[model samples]
Target chain A: MSTKTILCIEDDRFIGEMYIRSLKKAGYEIDWVVDGNDGLVAARNKSYDVILLDIMLPERHGTEILEALRGGKEDLIPKSYVIVLTNFQQDDQSRIAMEKYADAYLIKAEITPKKLISIIEKIQD
Target chain B: MEIKKGPQIASQFWPEFIKQKIVLIIVSQIIISIAVGCLIILSGFLAIGSIGFWLILGGFFVINLATELLIVISATRPTKDLLAAIINVSGEKSTLTPPNPNTKEYEKTGFRDALQKIYELSSVKDKQKTDESEKKDDNQELSIIEALNTTICGFITLDKNRQVIYANKPAPIHTNVDGIKIIDLLFNGNDTLDSWLDSCEEHSVHDEHVWTRIPDRLPNEEGRRFFDVIASYQKGSTAETVLTLIDRTKSYIVDEENLDFISFAAHELRGPITVIRGYLDVLGDELADVLVDDQSELFHRLVVSSNRLSGYIDNILNTSRYDRRHLKMNLAEDKISTIYDTISDDMKLRAGAQNRILNVDLPTKLPTVAADRASIGQVFGNLIDNAIKYSRDGGSVNVTAKQNGNFVDVSVTDNGIGMPESVVSQLFQKFYRSHRSRESVAGTGIGLYISKAIVESNGGTISVRSEDGKGSVFTVSLPIYSTVADKLLASNNSNVGLISEGNGWIKNHSMYRS
Candidate 1:
């Protein structure tokens, strides 16, 4: 049997609730954090399959959270891969995220709900 | 200065001679007749003469001469009364547009009342009416020509020889020229524009002709803050040159203020869009895959709203440039073909969404016109966008280019809802739109006016023609830059960061997919 935990961090309550309902429906145990500070602490304390990062977050900001996970700060337990969520276009961020070891960034509008499932499942594999 | 005692200029002395000739000729004839009568009487004395006979003959001659002089007096009366009658009649016949006639409404009260109103207007100088009042519901049009003579933007038209063919009242005050050589309005001896004038005259007879333009900062006085004087070919069956003076200083200041706001807003907005994209990537494809539920609908709504919001923001930013009316052209040597291709590609998405077709027929090899690249690009974009917006569903828009020696002509043709002759008449008016806009099209009515202003600023011209039901075509001509910009371009020849590089930080956006 395969078992994995996913940390979904988001600021928009509507999309945050969608993530909790959808990922759990897909049968992965999910840890949901609303703010950037909670997301930072949860990543450090828990072991998770993957980290779902929302670039726009209310607390502690998305980039600072990425830098912290990249070991910008002292320590974190789970060495989970990071997948970015963004609406802005331009290759620079994708290139830089890879330089810092981020797995991928999905352009927000370009992806549909069905497509979003495929990308998440592949990353889980 | 010696006053020459010889015959003066013909015009001046001809009147005096005419006056005196009638008096001199009449008086002399009377004397000569009187003398002849005396001679006849005295000579006849040898036959049947009495002293009374000579007196009666002389008196009869005097009376005849007196009658001739009185007839001449009536003939010599000036035509001033005739001119007064004509002015009074024409003023009564033709409608006095707006503010001029606003007071005339009192005339329906009675003839006595109308005369009283006329007396009132006569007492108040025309200057008392505010500019706002002049703009009353195109309800009426007063002779803007009459307004020009006094309020300041003097209107003047000159012929090929720099002769003052027409001058409105305020010409001397605005131009600071005291009825001197008409060419003096355009050039001074210190400025040698003989060669430049040659370039301008070539356009005079052609479909588009223009003179060398020297836009200098207008001497700043209180009301005369800054003015732009444009001399362009007013195309007609027989083409005439038209010069328009626009006071841009107030509009210029407003533009500067708007530009500042845009830069500030743009800078702040970019940071948030970058952060939003970062979160989207982290959520993975799972976020979009949820659309089967109501949650997905929310996602769709979010995307649509943001896209529309951003589009409006971009329009405001673009128009802000022309607002200040302060356009500093960074002139460069550029190929028209490449420029056309770039604009076509950039606007392809807008066309695709509307299912509109854009056909560009530019020559493989093109002559270069010296111009501001970004400004010209925006001009093309606005024109094409207008075409697409007004076009029938799935209609085609065509662009064609050709060079005639010193200028490049670009025409954009659209098989769209054509403009009626009435609307077409004011095609380039600010905030002017046809009745069709109220029905289907959307616009601010400022696009063409701004486009015309930009093309003219760069020593170019823009024109249009449209049939009521068929379609419309807009043609623009820009002078081909021969040398200066090309030389500068040769030295700074790197294509790296030549265009807008967007704001600084890119690594800040990583982990973005889709």
Candidate 2:
């Protein structure tokens, strides 16, 4: 089987590093982007099995990036599953991300890195 | 006032009423002329006969005076009827009519026509005067409304039918012209505006101002804008209002930012805590064979303390979420006993950790509740945790459940450091840690508040009963799934489910759908 790849777009450096460490340890190839703009560019460049996107980012919001990717004239990254990982747990943001075709909404502080990786593995299966 | 003035002028002004006087004068002159000529001719014949000539002259003079008086009296009678007709027309008592036809032909037709023309002119002048005053009043009212529109955040006036009669600058800024109903402009999409307004009408009280978040579709960019809506019904007036929205965006944004900061801070704190816990778990598992007895116990203590701190952080975040109305609930139909069973093991473990005995008694036939199972668990979990926290060493903390009428009443009774009546009343308030427990107990003081919010949002009530130096019983009463069905059956027992049929509540089938 081909190697499973994941993209983690998070602004928090430590959390992002922790996720990268845990997922790589779990034998999954992972790419991490710290800002929304770079994440958008990276998401368009290649397809991944899972893309963990954060709502709050440095340059642009994750919702806007998701909208640009999925709500465009052509589907920018149809093969990738977008999971919204955010510290902000507001209803409108959730609704917007879901409406823009996000596959899952998870609070970053609520779930552990191991559990997140296990979820990704389940999606792969 | 205008009608009275018209009649007053017609009565007091004598010259304007001369159409009748002119006719009387002409008829009296003709009668006098004919009488003088006849008398003169008759007296001349008497004088020629030379006997009783003086008596004949005297007789002619008396006959002439009598004819003149008769002519004057007849002319005055027609004039009085003409005056009565004029009074009637001016009083708006009847339509215009000519005087009784006792006078000459010119007096009948010509005098009546001239009089009618004069009356028409006067009536038109009165109408013009009234119109001018009304126009002035209208202009004054317009200026007042314009001033209000400029000074206030927004102003919208609806006519009795609730159609927009006037809307000011900020009105169009929020409520686009596409939204015709005033309710559309005022209500946030979280609730149905029509039903809310109908309730408002039914209550007949518009004294309260409701705070609503403006929908995102409107041109508010900074964040979600809020408006304070005040509605007043103007009975028998031009405007019957649904509501008026006053822009409260600035203060609302400040409040939102504060709440957001709390949520952000709580999440930031929890992130490191989770990582620490994650690493600790990995270490404990990896080194389980190598660690000694004391080290293992120390690690276990660390994990318990970390978990406790994590729970506190969660409480803070949940409190922030509840305050901002961002808490999402996934409601489902489940038996109350099932919820109790799910959390009873966890509650017992937590209580055992704190050196307390936790007892749970669940009735077998408890009805199902339409509630978010996880949220209800949290609510019950918080109450049990509080019971354990407050109880003395080895004290009994009883969690009991029973069916009470339409509700399932679950009570958490603790025999520990009981709070006073005053403290019990303030227990559920945000950030209200009790004075007695603050020194020894570690808590965020928001667990009870969050629990109350969760319970209430699930169509339940949470209340406490306590006495000074005695234990407290915190009871959560949730309305059962069949409660509405039972009420529906009782209110209209013969009709079954059709009572709320079109209103979307199917009696036995989906009354618990919400």
Candidate 3:
């Protein structure tokens, strides 16, 4: 249908709005979730080209949710793609998140919404 | 010979100890010689009568008495000669035996016995001990002579005329001069030495060794060495000055290292922390709607950590400002009630996440305090931040501000775990944190220190009182108005933090609400 379907899961209002605006302009079909439980439900019900997630959340943390989705425990959603968005730049956190099948790690300060959108699009291609 | 007058003064004048044997020896020798002299006279007397022999014996006896008196005088002559020689050589005087009354126990012992006695008085090995002692005294005298004649540490001694009398070893090395006045030694280049010496000479007495370290830096050198010098005057003697030098390069090096560590640490922490907090702000926008479903304890922890990290980064930033002494502040006239109001409303939402309560005790007729409003706001904001971080779940914080005699006193009382006694004393010390805080809270311990500085700079005083397991009260008093800076110090407390609770605002906030 669309160029690609991207599921965006994040907890911060400012950055989420920025991502939503930029991804929409990037010409991608997107479904958004602010809560971790909602994220699980959204992914389970629909198929997406990629998922952009935040590490710290009010529901389940981005890392924990990513772990469950990629652990192959419930296979609630088709394992299409997953990317982590966080402010922390520690190497250990990156390694652990990647080990759990997070497709990309981008520092929020180093990347803006448009920059992140292009990178995700490139990965999809 | 008789005993000397040293141990017994009165016995020196008494000639009762001449001894009969020495008297007899002198008498016999005199009789043998004088009898021969009288022999010719006796022969003439014998031709006339027996009176010749009697006259000869009498003449011999008289000669022996004269000879004994001369021998006694000659025996004491060496001591009198030495005393006169020393008086002529040194040109100073002491309580010495005058030649008019001198005595000695010449028959008491030999030179070996005398040397053995000297060795007993000395604390040294017996072998050449006399020589060793003499050598040591000679060395001491040589050192003192060198110190007096040279410019060791620029030292010199002068008489009442201010003429050069003595100098030290370092004087020449330091000043490259010899034989200068005491005043010249202190102020060889500066004119102040001239006036200071004039004043001391005119007014001061009993020249009690006045010592001061004179610091001088070499041309083009960044540091200076200190020279310690002292001067003292005996009652009847000329005043003397002694000096010593000390180098402080190592101490300066240590200070530089401390500054380096603080600056390095400050920059290292803030770079990554600013990025982390920025991302957290991004997450708040994205997770607003979805966060309501799984409001687990884990989410609360994540929120608290982010806030704590943000506070830590701010602490680092504050430290950098403090180091430069160029810290920024916004001074304004603000009412105490207003500051409390802003904190209550804004801070409540923050406290709500952790389920804590803030009780405000503000007087309606509050006094207006003149201070840096933003810095003051930050001060209490940090206090409230610490209150929430340190308090257990469901604890309460009480804030009170009252007017008392041209000042407004504010107190923040928390029902949190109290700090250690040692920590309380240094609560306002920069970078000093409690062991409990290290484990329980994520903070830059500089909050209280900064608060104290902020309060004091605005003509106010801040203090803390805490008891372990009981609670803590931080009190701040500020002048009514008309001051510039609010804090006394710009604190760098980067290692301070607070632990997080399971149910926290980081998870349940309007920013994160869908």
Candidate 4:
């Protein structure tokens, strides 16, 4: 089987580092971006199996990037699974992510990093 | 300040109104007199011979014309005076004496007298109508004033001269100082009422606190009483200033206690939950390869329990938010299908864990709803969770969603031990749980309350239909989002046929099946 690559877009330093380390230990390649704009650029630049996008970000909102990725005219990246992982508990935020064609919505505080990886593995299968 | 107005006349009916009728009468009389003169001349010509007969006819014609002229001349002045008198009676003009009845004018005053009578009758009718309307207005004002005086909120009104116009009973109750100048009440005798009054004219003031030190407010009552004062200058013919005062002592105490408890609980619970989840993640990561089969299962169970505990904490926090009326919705357009898809797996897992069956019947396409996604998810999650909890004995929980008129209605049906009528009525109340459910299931009893608040704040309704020994169906109806054109078309349904069609759709859609 080919190696799987994951892109994590998170604003919080500790959460991003934790997920990256955990996923790397799980034997998958991981690339992490800290801001919304950089996440958008990286997602547009490279193809990955899954993208973990956070809602609250610095330069741009994670949902806006997702909207652009799915509906933008520019053909930047191939079709990939988009997972929204954020601390925001608002219904509108979750709905917006899903409406923009998100594959999964996970609250980071509710589930363990390893559990999240298992869910991602299931989705990949 | 109330302005005094004198009794007003309906000036539309004036001297000109009487003059027009009198002119008609005089013109008709002159026409009749001319016809009489012509008849007299014709009879004389028929009865006598040529030259002498013509002379007598002319004499009779002259006599008739003279009499008519005398009558017209005498009637004109008296009729004008009588019209003026009638108008005065109607309050349109100043009082005037009616023309003397013993004079020549009285002989021609019949038409004037009859007109005066008609004017008097109409004036009385007009007066009745005015009095009735005024009485209604006065009653309304009096009732409103009484209500204000009896309420707990204080009301004080000032005239443009800055003098007190009115003060309700609660004004003194809240402020502890009445009959004092408003400026002094606000400034505490610092003499800045003029500038404050000037400033109020430009803009309204809001939420200003006033602390009055009343040494002898009561026996041994020396502390200052706090009041929330809101003032505004009303601009009109008579400019006035209105001030409202509210006592905030008791409510402030209650708010402080509630806030303290919520903050303490949130901090204490959230900190530990985060730490425990973090440690559990570390353990799962560190022991993933070394754990035995049963050990792995145990770990998974622990994770599930932890997740459940965290959700309870979230619900508790949300309940407090609802208590404070602080659940701000982030509204957006989204499909109800997305919510169904997101929570379907969770619901299935939850129901299966309790030895219950979960059935989901979601439409392939539904109208987009104006909603907050996370809030809607929480609402559905709470309902589905409740179903699983209440129907844990291998019962089936059916979930369905479909388009109903302008809404997307979703229902969670559970064939569990249903609640009695009394218990069901209070199901959505805060911290209320049925006795049977309380004994059988462990719950905080605030989940349904928070769910209801979340749903209602997002412009939806949550209702339930159930019977004793039968299952319960909890339904939530959310309004569908419409495009600009669709909204315009919907609003333009002014035709009776279209309106009835809409009503029929509503009735058909609102009907529920057991």
* Strongest candidate by lDDT: 2
Candidate 2 C-alpha lDDT tens digits along B1-514: 4454423544444444455555665566557655655675676654434556556655655676566557656766546556656665557443335354335764655665655665677689789989999999999999987787786566667675657777775563444588764433433222344545466567754433454544323332344556666656644467666456777777566645665676778777866775776666556656899998778767766765665666666667666666555665555556777876645645655665677887788877788876666568778878888887887888999988888887889999998778887887678765679877899898767799788878877767899988666788999998887765454335433223211110011123232122
RMSD of each candidate relative to the true structure: 20.7, 11.8, 21.4, 17.1
The local distance difference test score of each candidate is 0.58, 0.67, 0.58, 0.65
Mind giving the per-residue lDDT tens digits that candidate 1 earns over B1-514? 9776744433334356557767786778878886776676577653336657756765777787778777766554322222223334334432222222224433453433444454456445444555446677243545554566667664557566555566665453234367553433323112233444466566554433232322232222223333445555543423255555554556554544554576458534644543343244345355666556666545544443343334333344434434433334445566777666645544665666567888888896668887666567667877887888888989999988999767898899999888888888677754568777867777766577667766776667888898877888988887887834555467544321222111111122223332
Docking quality of model 3: it rates as incorrect
Docking class of 2: incorrect
Best-to-worst ranking by TM-score: 2, 4, 1, 3
- Give the C-alpha miss distance for residue A85 in model 3, angstroms: 24
The TM-score of predicted model 1 comes to 0.39
Kindly report which residue stretches of model 1 are placed more than 4 angstroms away from their true locations once superposed: A1-125, B1-320, B323-325, B340-346, B360-363, B478-514
lDDT of candidate 2 at residue B38, scale 0 to 100: 63
Candidate 3 chain A worst ten-residue window by lDDT = A88-97
Q: Using TM-score as the measure, which candidate wins? A: 2
**Which candidate model has the greater lDDT, 3 or 4?**
4
DockQ of candidates 1 onward, in order? 0.03, 0.10, 0.02, 0.10
lDDT of 4 by residue, B300-350 (tens): 666656656766666776665554444555555667878666556556656
The TM-score, computed over Cα atoms with residue i paired to residue i, of candidate 2 is 0.52
